[model samples]
Target: MSMRSPYPDVEIPEVSLTEFLFADGFGDRADAPAFLDGTTGDQLTFTEFHGLVEKIAGGLAARGIGKGDVVALFAPNLPQWAALFHGILRANATVTSANSMYTGGELAHQLTDSGATTLITVSPFLDRALAGATEAGLSADAVLTIDKAEGHDSLADLVSSGAPAPELTTTADDTAVLPYSSGTTGLAKGVILTHRNLVANLLQVHVMGSVTDQTKIMAFLPFFHIYGMTVMMNQGLHTRATVVTMPKFDLEQFLSITQKYAVDRLYIAPPVAVALAKHPIVDSYDLSCVKTIFSGAAPLDGELGRAVAKRLNCTVLQGYGMTELSPVSHCMPDDRGDLDLNSSGFALPNIECKLVDPESGKEVGVGERGELWVKGPNVMVGYLNNSDATDATKDADGYLHTGDIAVVDDEGVYSIVDRVKELIKYKGYQVPPAELEALLLTHDKIADTAVIGVKDAEGEEVPKAFVVKQASGADLTEDDVMAFVAEKVAPHKKVRVVEFIEQIPKSASGKILRKDLRARETEQA
Candidate 1:
C-alpha cells in the first residue's frame, strides 16, 4: 500500500494497542474514572481498566488463546465491552464487535463469518449468545459474563484477580479489530481492521480536533456499531476524555446526561438531531456546555444545524464514512464552511479522497458530482475472509471506493449530493434524493422524508418518495409536495410522486431504509 499523504507531517504510531494507550499516557491516572457505566455506578479508572485488561489477557492466555485468534464481543456499551476489547488485543487476538440488538439469526451469521472461538457477553444475553454460538458451529471455550457469573466467570472478577500485565510483543499491523459492514449492495461482511487501522483513525480523529482529556463526551450511540465503537469508546480512551455512557438512548436520559456532566462533545445521528432541533424536552436542560456535537451513521441537515445551533450555541459538525473505514473519514473542521456549518468537509489529513465517475473509473471535475473514493491508513484492511468484496471495494492503488456520490470544490468542502445506488434515476439522468430530502426537512411543516426508485411498467424506473408529516392529522397532498420539489430541483429531479406515512423506516445505524421503502412499494403494487 502507498504510505504517503498530501500533508507530509502526518505521523503514524509504531506501537502495540496496549502500549499505545495504556503504557504511554497511563501515569498516576488510576484515581480518575476510566469509564462510567451509566446503567450502574460501576466506574473503572485507568489502573482498574488496565488491571482488568491484564486479567482478561491472562485468562485468555491460560485458555490457549493467542495471536491471530478471533474473539466475539456480543454486548452493549458497558464496562466489560471495553475490557474485552483491550483484553482480546492484549492476547494478540482480534475482536469482532456484534450489535447487541441483533437476533440469534443475525448473531449466528456474524459468528460463523468471523470464525470466532471465544465469545464474551453479558448475563442477559448469555442464553442468546450461547444458542447463537452453538448454531453457528462455534465450539465455545469460554463465555465471559458481564455481570452475574453464577455459572460463569465474571469479567470484573477475572480482571480483579490482581494479575499483572503479561509479557508479550505485538505489532500495530497485527489485526486487532474485526468490525462488520453491509456493503453498498450485499449481506453484511466482517471487516478486518488492524491496530494500525483503528489507531490511524484515532490519531487522525485526534489531529482533526476530535476531543481532548478536558472534553466530556456523551456516549449514547451503541458501542457495538463502528461509529460508537471508534468515536465513543476508543477515541475517549485515546484522548483520555471522560465518557458519560448511556445503556440506551432515552431522550430524557440523553438530556440529563448532558446537564449532569456538562458534556463538551456529543456524537449523534439524524434522529437525535431531530429531537434536539424540535423536541420540547430539550429546553429543560442546559446544552450550552457542549462545544462540539457530531452527527454520523446518517447524513445531517445543515438547516437542522441552523436550528440546533440557535439552541445549543455549539459547533455542529458532520462527516461521511462507514464501517469499512473504521467508520469516520472526516470531521467537519472548525474552519470548514465557516466552522462546521455545512458539507462533510475534506478528507482527514492523512486520508486521500477523489471523486470518480460511477460507470467509468475516471476522475470528475472539481465541484462535479461523482462517487467519492477514499484512501487512507484508517481504511479497513479488507472484509474478513471475503476477498472478492474487498478486492472490489479497495482498488489496486489502495483507494476504498465509497458508494456515496459527492461534489467537491476547490475549497476542499465535500457535500454528499446523492448516493450512487440510493439515488433516483429518472429516465437516464441521476436525481440526488438527498437534495430533495434536505429541502423537505427544512420545511417546519414536514418531519421525515425518504426517496427511492420504483420500476415502471415499461421496465424503467421513476422517482417516488414517502414522507412522514410532522404535525398530527396534517392534510398534505402529493401534488403539494411534488410542487415543492419541482420548484427546487430540475424537471427530471422532481418528486413526481409522494405518499404520506406516519414514519420513515431507518436502520439502527441511522441510515434511511431505501430498500425497506422499496419493499413497501413492492407490497403496495
Candidate 2:
C-alpha cells in the first residue's frame, strides 16, 4: 500500500511556467529587489527583472531561437542567469542548464545531447564554452557570452535587438528545462521537466516552507542543479523574496553575505552544514538574522544538524529529493524543527509514496527499509529521448521507482538509509561510477576499476576506486590515480581514495558488483 502525504493536495494550475510566475505581476513589490549579486552588490528589482525577461525573449526571438529550440546556459549563478532562464521559456524555447564546473568534453555531451542551437556563458568560461561548442559541432558564432567578449555576441547585444517579445506559445506540458542527471545508474541524461513539472513543484514546496515577500534567501548553491533551480531560484521568485546570489561558495563570503543581507532563509546541502557546525570562522559573523537553514541534496546527520541549530540558535531542517522528481518529495516544514533531523519530514502535498522491499517486491510496513517509489504531478514527464531509461525508472502505473532505500515511521516521516542505485553523491553532486570507470580505463596503468561511494573520516561521501593494476603499472601510486582523475573531472567527482586489488568483483553478466566492494569497505572499517 502506498502512503499518501499527510498534507492535503494542492491544486496545480495548467498554465505555462512563465505565465504562472510572471502573469500575476509583482504589484506593490514591483520595485523590490528580486535578486542581488552578493559579491558586487548589484541587484534587479521585480519590475526590472520582468522587463529584462521581455527584452531577452525578444533578443532570443530575433536570433532565430523560437518554439522548441533548446539554449544551453553554462554560466555561474548571476542575476542574469535567472532572467535568461525565464526568457528562454518566454520565447517558447527550452533551457538545458550545464554544470558550471564541467570540463569541455563533459559539457560537449550535454550540448550535443540536448541539441542546443546556441550556447550562452560568461567571459571567464569562454575557453571551455568554445571548446565544448566546437566539439559539439557548433561554430564560434553560435556562442554568446553573458558578459562582453571581444568577438562574440554579448547579453547586451541580444537586448539591443529591441525586437518585440514574441507570443508565449508554450503550454504547461511543453518541456521547459532539461537538467541532466544520472538517474538510478548510468551516464547523465537530460531529465525532461515540463512547465507543469516546474510549476507544480513550486506550488508543492510553497506549502511546506515559510517563505514570504519579507524573506531573504541566500543562494550559494549552483543554479544548474534541480535543488537550486526549484527550491531556491523559482521559489524565491514565486514568493517575491529577495535572493542573494553567489557565483561559488566560500566560507567567509557566505557568512559575510548572510550577515550583510540579513538573509533569513538559507538553502544549502549537507557540506555547508558541516562548515556551520565545525568551522571556527563561522563565529566571526553574526548569523542572528538567520531563521532557518534547510539542507537537501544528500542526507544530513541528525547530530550535526542539531549542533548547527544549537550553535546558531536557529532551525535546521532536512529534505530528500532526486532530479527525476523535479527534485523535492519529502522535507521538514519550517516550523517542524522538533522532528528528528535525520528523517526527511513529510512528503509534500500532491505526492503519494510507497516503500517496497526490493527483493520481496512487497510494500514494507513502517520501520522496514524499502525502495521509495513516488507518484506526483511534480514528477518529470520522462528522460529526454531515452525511452529505455524512462521505462526503467518510471513504471506504467505512474509511480517513479526512486532507487533510494528508505524507512518511514508511524508519523509518515521517512529517512533514507541506503541506495539501490550506484550513483554517488559527493557534496550534493551526482558522480556516476560508470563515467569514472570508463574514464579510468583510458589510463594504461589501470586494468580494471570499479568506483563506489565511501565515507571519509569527516563522514562525507567521496568516490573510492577499487582497481586491478596493469602488470606494467606496479609503480602506480594512489596519488597518481587521484591526480589523473582530478585533472579530468569536476572537483566533487574526483577519486579521493584508491586501492589496488588482484581482481574486481563482478557478476556473471560482467557487471561490477558494487555491493561486494561496499561490503569490503565495511569489513575494512
Report the number of the highest-TM-score candidate. Answer: 2
What TM-score fits each model? 0.79, 0.99
Worst 10 residues of 1 by lDDT: 1-10
Model 1 agreement with the true structure over 1-525: per-residue lDDT tens digits? 122233434688887767878877566555777788665657888777877788888878777787868889988787668877898889878888887766565678788898888788888887778778888886544677777757776776666656554577679888887776665545567888878888788787776674767777788787877888888898888878777788778899888878876888888876678788898999999887988788777667688877886788887888778788987886676544364455887677688787888887678877688888888888888888788988988889888887889877665767887776564444433455665687677766688888777766744457777888877538777887888776645455677778888889889998998878877887999
Predicted structure with the largest lDDT when compared to the true one: 2
Model 1 Cα displacement at 511 (Å)? 23
How many collisions per candidate?
0, 0
* lDDT: worst 10-residue window of model 2: 484-493
The CA lDDT of each predicted structure is: 0.76, 0.94
Clashes of 2: 0
Instruction: Assess the local accuracy of residue 368 in candidate 2 as a C-alpha lDDT between 0 and 100.
Output: 92
- The residue-level lDDT of candidate 2 at 375 comes to 97
For residue 32, model 1's alpha carbon misses the true position, in angstroms, by: 1.7
lDDT of 2: 0.94
Query: Which residues of candidate 2, in runs, are more than 4 Å off?
Result: none
